[model samples]
Target: MNLEWLKGIYVPILTPMKEDESVDFEKLRKQVNFIIDGGVHGILAHGSNSEFYMFEDDDYEEIFKVILEEVAGRVPVIMGIGAIRTSKCVKLAKLAERLGADAVAILQPMFLKPTDEELYYHFKTIADSVKELPTLLYNNPRIGYTLSSDLVERLARDVRNIVGIKDSSGDINQLLEFIRKTRDLKFKAFGGKDTLLYSSLNIGAVGGVCTTANIFPELVTSIYNTYVDGDLKESLELQFELNPVRMSMDKASFPVATKDMANINGMDVGKPIKPNHASPSGVVESMRKEMAKAGLLKG
Candidate 1:
């Protein structure tokens, strides 16, 4: 398969839960259709928003099965394999590959903070172990461990199967540097921050894995499409219109606000995983107002 098929806005879809905290498969199916209908290029199952780390192995398998059946080839599905150990990650990756996932997105091992060399070997081993399956590196400094540009370049050069990166560090300069340093390499680069989508596209980044797209997939897709269509002015303006909701949502826990926005838009994506504080009434009200102002929600 063409690795470039993974390009464009990929939503790290949230796992909506029932009141008893079980995965709401019916609601999730609606969510998948909603995102596909809204024009996202692909969907990422069990990323940060999907609470992949919080789930047990059996739960992940079940959720993946549901996602695969729901999507059913409507669009490509990139599975998230963010296990704490590389062995478990490889296991999940193999499962995803066997189940016909388009690609696997992995974050660096957290907590232990492996050295650059360790990190390199970790990814190289996973890529090698997975063989032909394309892998995308997920770099989010806000989460704790940061993948350095040098290591990223090294991986791109050494690991042919490692196909792309999702840079969510929120630093446009760092993203630009990643693009600059890795330009000759075959790996695709994507923006992870919603606010920097425009600049990321301008600087040769392929697309985005944006949380904001959960609520405004069309608008986010418009930003990318407009830019690619050479309407930089319109794309930038859409980004400006989207900035308020993006900023507000970032101020709170991620999938919390994201699911709320999805619910407001008539998709019944349920609550975030436990231990996350419930979104305040005022915050939801403000988000509603901002969504209206951004034209994402009708008055």
Candidate 2:
């Protein structure tokens, strides 16, 4: 497959849920259009922000189907198959391929610290299971371990289908190393942190798998489009403007703030899944004020 089209802003879309925490297909479809129209180059259906671990295989297919249907070839879609078990990961990757996903992203297995060799087998097996869909390694250290650049290089060399990696380690040097090491291969490195989008591109990363794009895609896309358009000054200015809002998310619970911002902006994305309750009213109020100040919400 041609990996050239993979270069640009991609949103690890938030799964819209209802009061009971079930997938809201209606809202989900609308969101697919919301971001596409907002100028994102592509969409990630079951990304980390989508809460992939919370659903079953059948639920995964349903969510993937709705997103694919709504997207309808407007932009490439990558389905995230993030699971602790290799079997579940392969199963979801196959499901994504059957549903016509443009690619699959395997998030680092959580709760288990596998050795380098074991990690290689885990990712390679998933990539080998598919026929031709491009595969991306999601190196998120939040899972307790990181994919060393050496391991990433080995995968890129040995696996024909492993096309790229999303380095969410929040370490630019590590991301730079991945790019530097894989510079010759047909590999792409994407910045996984919202704060480092511009810098990532500056250092030769293809794009970013930014969570903030779930709320303000245009803001994030501008950073990519502007940079690509040869306006580094404007791109850096946009990135600076986005930093505060992205940083503020740390104040609220993980992932809740994305949904909260969507709802605050009247997207009505619904509450996060149960046990991961909505942000406190004060937190929500504070986020609202922050967004308004950022020009995301007009008071």
Q: Which pairs of residues collide in model 2? A: none
Worst 10 residues of 1 by lDDT: 248-257
How displaced is residue 67 in candidate 1, in Å?
Answer: 1.5
* Model 1 per-residue lDDT at 25: 83
Any idea what lDDT model 1 has?
0.85
Top of the candidates by TM-score = 2
* Candidate 2 TM-score versus the reference: 0.97
Candidate 2 wrong stretches, greater than 4 Å: none
Which residue pairs come into collision in candidate 1?
none
Task: Estimate the TM-score of every prediction.
Answer: 0.96, 0.97
Candidate 1 colliding pairs, count: 0
